[model samples]
Target: MNVFEVRGGKKLQGEIVPQGAKNEALQIISAVLLTPEEVTINNIPDILDVNLLIELLSEMNVKVNRTSRSTCIFKADDVNIDYLHSPEFKKKSGRLRGSVMLAGAMLARYKKAFIPKPGGDKIGRRRLDTHVIGFQKLGTQLDYNQEDGFFHLTAEELKGTYMLLDEPSVTGTANIVMAATMATGTTTIYNAACEPYLQQLCKMLNRMGAKISGIGSNLLVIEGVDYLGGTTHAMLPDMIEVGSFIGLAAMTKGDITIKNAGINDLGIIPEKFRQLGIAMDFKGDDIHIPSQDSYTIQKYLDGGVLTIYDHPWPGFTPDLLSIVLVTAIQAHGSVLIHQKMFESRLFFVDKLIEMGAQIILCDPHRAVVIGLEREHQLRGITMSSPDIRAGVALLIAALSAEGKSTIQNIEQIDRGYQNIDTRLQALGADIKRVAI
Candidate 1:
């Protein structure tokens, strides 16, 4: 196991570049299986989840070449379809949630796909119904074995039709879109997820000769194509990490500039941080957060407490709510953190409370935070990470606390953020990664 020992009370200053998008990397890497030509991808984050998915692809005999630390070329001219049925395949695929996306590309090319139940953060009940129903809409037969926890899907020839998803699930949308690209007719998807992750997938497929419209909208139309070719695609900067750094600068009173943050796609993240009284200067594509001694939480004009909640895309992302909650600990006023998407995410507030913050866990999905106003600094303590986003949030909290803190199970952190300790150390953070 690995742990992070952080000596707190140091102000981090300097420029930090956010890693490439982890969420988008999963979808884009899976798309490479749709074609047999060389698909070159740049700006790939060297993280555990993506590396594991790439290993799975290699195990299936897909030609993968590492051109650089952050660039890879993939040619799936010959695939080991028999490997997908082995026990080893199920064991490896169950390690990461993104493994579920392989079914889309596999089914599109081979007319069959099988996978064990995917594994990922245990934040909530992440249902696979969206993916199953979307595939069934395109004339695919689905079967599940409850005892072994495996999914079997087969299709002779997919005929595209209209599909209205129950929710705009991001991975669900990507899976369905990839499957529909080679169908026999036009496929229309309503209530599709339009996040940049899906948008990038659609654009990449379009470059590879897939007919897709409605790139950044809730409705997508894909025309069936006989074949797809090779293409090059680059990933966007991770918005979640950008939000995490913005919260970190506010908590530690640091002057930090995030370079090449993909400013236009950030949507309401910068404004949402401003709602918590964290000011940011946008200089071109970079976000500059100036050092401030203190900041005040905002309230409604009717004298109501401020509430930060998550919604679908084009709204505040749910991934950064934990960071925002921790950032509000030293603000001037109280704020409500509503995690509408996941139930178990807010349960980690008890760890923060142990570190001398005033927090009330109203329910499974809501918390009321009363700022200490810098009157008393938080005293760090030993804690375990619960999920990827919450793990980074606790690290931010540890950076601003008064004493040393130890965080275990940092593999959860490693699964998303690339070289986190090294990157933060470059900005003057007192953190060290040690083996336990």
Candidate 2:
């Protein structure tokens, strides 16, 4: 296990670049299985979960070539279909939630996909029904074993039709789109996730000879092609990490320039931070945040308390709600944080309360943070990270606190953010990684 010892109250100043998008890497890597030729992907984040997926691919006989720290070429010319049912695959596939995406590509290419129950942060119940239902809609028969915790899917020449998903699940959309790309007919997916990651996936598939229309919209029409070819694709900068840096600069009172932050794809994130009265200046693809001694929260025009919530795309993302909640702690006013997509993410607010921040856990999915406004500095303490987002939120809190703070279970942080402590240290943050 690893722990982060942070000495707070130090103002960070420097330039940092956001890593490649982790979510996009998952979908893109799995798409390699759709084609037998070589697929070169650039800007892949060297994070724990992604590495695990790459290792899983290698274990399945996909030839992987590492060209650089952030670039890789994958050739799936001889994928071992028999390995899918092996104990090794079962063990490796269950290590990350993104592994479920392999089922879609595997089913598209091999007509059979076996997946163990995927594992990830236990913030809430993440259902696989969306994935299963989407696969069934594409002419795949699904079977599940409760005792063994495995999903077995088989199909004979997938024939696509119209599918209106129950929800616009990010992974579900990617999986169904991948499966539909090689199907026999045109597939129309309504209410698909139009996130930049998904859009990038669509672009990559198109370059690989898949006919996909409506790139950045909810309704996607995928005309199944007989085969897909290899293509080189570059991933966009991680928007979640960019959002995290914005919150870190505000809460710790620092000046940071996030280089190549994919600013155009970041919808409403900076505007949401501005609602917390943080000053952000944009120059091309870089975001500059100036040090602020104090910031004030905005109230509604009707004189009501401010509320920040997550919706689908073009709105706030639920992944950054914890960061928003933590950054609001030092603001001059109050705001309600509502995480509508998942439950139990707000439970980490108790640790903030322990650190002398005024917060009310209204429910499993909502919290009201009363900003201290620098009237008093937060006193740091020891805590355990609950999940990836909350762990980063706690790290931000520690960076802005008064004394020493120790955060355990930092592996969760490593799963998403690549070399986070090292990146923060380059910006003058007093964070040290210690093995325990």
Candidate 3:
């Protein structure tokens, strides 16, 4: 196992170009299976999850070549769809949660897919009913062998139809968009996730000759095409990483500049962080995060407690809620952090509380954070990372504490962050990665 040993109280100072979005990388890499031509994708994040997805593609006989640190050339010339059910492949697919998306790509290409149960954070019961239900709406017959934990989706010809999703599932929307792009009729997706990553998917699909309307809204009307040709599309910068850096700079009192942040694609992030008194100044495509020892939580005009809640897209993302909660602990005022998406996310607050953070776990999904404001420093503590966002949250908390901190289970962090220790070290962070 690997652990991150962080020497606390180091201010991050430098410019960082965020890596490619991991969420998008997984979905896009899976999309390669839809066509049997050489498709080049740029700005690929070399994260653990992406690497795992690439291995999944390789097992399916897709030729993947790493052309650069952030580029790859993929050709799914001959897809062995049945290989996805092999025990070895199944284990790799189970390594990360994003493996479920392969079902869509395989079904689109070979008309049949068998995907094992995905493995990821036990944040809560992350259900696949949303994925299955969406595909079933497109004329897919779903069968599962629970003994082997495999889901079989078989569709002769997918017919597009109207779908009101059970919820705004990010990956579910991606799967449906991929499946519907090659379907026979016009597919109108309501309550789809229009995050920057999803927008990238839509843009790439459009470049491949799929007529898609409603680019940045809840409803996506995708007109199916007979076939999609290969095209080049650049992935967007990692907004989650950008937000994490912004939160780190604010909490650690450091000045940092993020280059080519694609500030326009950021949906409600600046205003959302501004609610916590964290503001940024943009110069064209760059974002400058100024140093601040502390800032007051912008109280409601009614003089009541401020609440920061996470919702679907066009609102705050639940993934960033943990980072915001950690940031609020370093600010000067109190605020309520509500994570509505996952039930077990707030349970990690016990680790922060043990390190002297003033947080009250109001419930399974909510926390009330009282800021320390540098008057009281969080003492060094040993903790284990639970998930990707929570792991990064603990890393931020560890970096701002008074003494040394040891954080294990960094594989969770590796799932989302591509060489995060190296990235932070480049920004003057006192963090080291070592095998334990």
Candidate 1 lDDT, 1-436, residue by residue in tens: 8899999898889999999999999999999999999999999999999999999999999999988869999999999988887888888888798998998888888889987877879798888899999999998999887876778899999899999999999999999999999999999999999998889999999999999999999999999998999999999999999999999999999999999999999999998899889989999999999998999999999999999999999988899999999999999999999998899999889999999999999999999999999999999899999899999999999999999999998999999999999999999999999998
Alpha carbon deviation, residue 171, candidate 2 (Å): 0.7
Q: Which window of 10 residues has the lowest lDDT sum in candidate 3?
A: 102-111
Per-candidate alpha-carbon RMSD to the true structure: 0.9, 0.9, 1.2
Error of 2 at 346 (Å): 1.0
Q: lDDT scores for all predictions?
A: 0.93, 0.93, 0.87
Candidate 3 lDDT by residue in tens digits, 303-366: 8989999988888888899999999997888999988888999898999999999999989988
Tens digits of per-residue lDDT, candidate 2, 92-149, equal: 8877989999999998998999879778886988888888898898899888877766
Candidate 1 all-Cα RMSD: 0.9
Q: TM-score of each candidate?
A: 0.99, 0.99, 0.97
Alpha carbon lDDT of residue 17, candidate 1?
95
Residue 79 of model 2 has an lDDT of: 95
RMSD of 3: 1.2
Output the TM-score of candidate 2: 0.99
